[model samples]
Target: MVKNQPCIEIFEIFTAKRLHWVVKDKGESWTGQYFRDIILTERVFPFLKNEENVIDPDEVIFINDKAPCMRAY
Candidate 1:
């Protein structure tokens, strides 16, 4: 990682035999609002919409380890 060069964050889903991933630009620090609005909306949503992946939106589950930026207060 380089300073001020913009970093990328990846969100991945693993099924029994396959993996799905979404990549997005990351900021210096992640905030709860930013995580949802940018990462979830811009990256994850579009990735989930790819028909080739055979993902069911209703069956999708999101899990985070209670990172500060992922909590809703």
Candidate 2:
């Protein structure tokens, strides 16, 4: 039996016409380049328009491991 645990440590979402999401950890922000090798490269929303407050630390929560990968595909 495998335990169901979230892979994301922290995350945030900026709700607009579309959802812009960001993930951060260890006090370092994750840029697209940071995920260049990951599947997020193709699926991620380029960059926040006007560079608004996208992901709030308060909104951080646990996300299933497969959600991000499936959403990208």
State which candidate has the highest TM-score. Answer: 1
Model 1 agreement with the true structure over 1-73: per-residue lDDT tens digits: 5777755777676543357676655443476777688767776665555545534644555555664332111
Query: What's the TM-score of each model vs. the native?
Result: 0.48, 0.23
Residue-level lDDT tens digits of model 2 in 7-31: 5644434343345555544544466
lDDT value, residue 17 of candidate 2:
38
Off by over 4 Å in 2: 1-6, 26-73
lDDT of each: 0.57, 0.41
Backbone clash pairs for candidate 2 read none
Q: After superposition, how far is residue 70 of candidate 2 from its true place, in Å?
A: 32
